[model samples]
Target: MALMKLATTWERFILKDLTKFGRYAKVELTPPSPGELGQVVKGAGGFVKDALTFKWAQATVKEATVNTIVIAEIACWFFIGECIGKGSLVGYQV
Candidate 1:
C-alpha cells in the first residue's frame, strides 16, 4: 500500500510538471489570439458541462489541437474531482 501510494504520488508529480511544460511550450510555439484562447476555453467549458450533466465523453480539442487540449482537459478534470471528492472515471467502448 505504501509503495502504491508513493507511485501514485510520483505519477501525479510527473504529470503536473509535464503539463506545465507543455503549456509553456505551446505558448512559445504559437501565441494564440484572444479568439483562439476563448475558443479553447469554450471547448473545455462545453466538455465539463457535458461531462457533468450527461456523463458525456468527448474530446475537448479538435484534431489540430488534440495533444494540448487533451492534456489540459485531463488536468482540469483531475483537479475538479479532487475538489469535489470524486474520482475520474471514463467508460470504454468496445
Candidate 2:
C-alpha cells in the first residue's frame, strides 16, 4: 500500500512539472522573427560594449557564478555535439 502511495505521489509530481515545462516551451521554443532577430543583435552589441569596459568584472558573486555555469554548459554541449558528429568520444575515427 505504501509503495502504491509513493508511485501515485511521484506521478502527480511529474505531471505537475510537465505542465509547467509545457507552459514555458510554448513561449520559448519558437524561433525569433526578423524584428526579434534585430533586437537580439542590438542586445548582443550592448553586452559586447559592457565587456569592453570590463563591466562584467564588477558582477556580484552570485551573478558571476551563474554566468560561469552558463558558459560551462555551452562548452559542454559543444563538445557533446562534436562527439556525436564524429561518432567517437576520444578522437575522430579517421
Candidate 3:
C-alpha cells in the first residue's frame, strides 16, 4: 500500500508539471515572416501618424469618435502582428 501511494504521488507531481508545460506549448511562437514584419513596421508608423494628425488644439466630438476608431484599428494591427509572429493563423478566422 505504501508503495502504491508513493507511486501515485509521484505520478501526480509529474502530470502537474507536464500539464503546465502543455499549456505553455498551446501558443508556440515562431519569428514573424518577412511580410508580416514589414506590416508591423508600417503599422507602427501609421499609428504614430494617426495620433499626430489628431488636432489636439481643437478637440471636438467628431474627432473623439475618430480617435476611438483609430484606437481599434491599432489594436487590430497589434493582434495581426501577434498572430503572424506566432504562426497561429492556421484556420484562424482573423
Candidate 4:
C-alpha cells in the first residue's frame, strides 16, 4: 500500500510538471476577485453566440469573418461534446 501511494503521487506530480505553459506563468497579474471572475466567465459565454449570430450585428459584414463563424461553431461544438463526460484533461495545472 505504501508503494502504491508513492507511485500514484509520483505520477500526478510528473503530469502536473509536464502540462505547464511557462510563458503565461511569467505574467504579473493580480488574481481576479470571485465576482470579477464570474463576470469574465459570463462574458466568455458570448463567444458561442457571437460566433453563431454575429453577422446579424452588422449591416454589411466581411465575408472572411462570416466564414470564420461557421468553423468556430463546428470546433466549439466538438469541444463541448468532449467536455460533457470526461474527467481530467489538458485543463490541468490551471
Instruction: Provide the overall lDDT of each model, using Cα atoms, as 2-decimal numbers.
Output: 0.79, 0.96, 0.84, 0.73
Candidate 4 local Cα displacement, residue 44, angstroms: 0.7
| Model 3: per-residue Cα lDDT over 1-94, one tens digit each | 9999998998899888998888887656557789989999999998788679964546688987898899999999998998897778655555
Looking at model 1, the pairs that clash are none
Error of 3 at 4 (Å): 4.1
Q: Tens digits of per-residue lDDT for model 2 on 1-94? A: 9999999998899988999999999999999999999999999999999999999999999999999999999999999999999998987898
Of 2 and 4, the candidate ranking higher by lDDT: 2
- Give per-model TM-scores: 0.30, 0.62, 0.39, 0.28
lDDT of 2 at 50: 99
lDDT of 4 by residue, 1-94 (tens): 9999998998889767755644456453558789989988887777667768874466456766876898899999988777664645556344
After superposition, candidate 4 runs with Cα above 4 Å error = 1-29, 56-94
Q: Between candidates 1 and 2, which one is better according to lDDT?
A: 2
Q: Which candidate model has the greater lDDT, 1 or 4? A: 1
Clash totals in order? 0, 0, 0, 0
Better of 3 and 4 by TM-score: 3
lDDT of 1 at 50: 70
Q: Which has the better TM-score: candidate 1, or candidate 2? A: 2
Cα lDDT of model 4 overall? 0.73
Ranking the candidates on TM-score from highest down gives 2, 3, 1, 4
1-94, model 1: which lDDT tens digit per residue? 9999999998899888999999999879987899999999999999788778865445444643876778899999987777566433443333
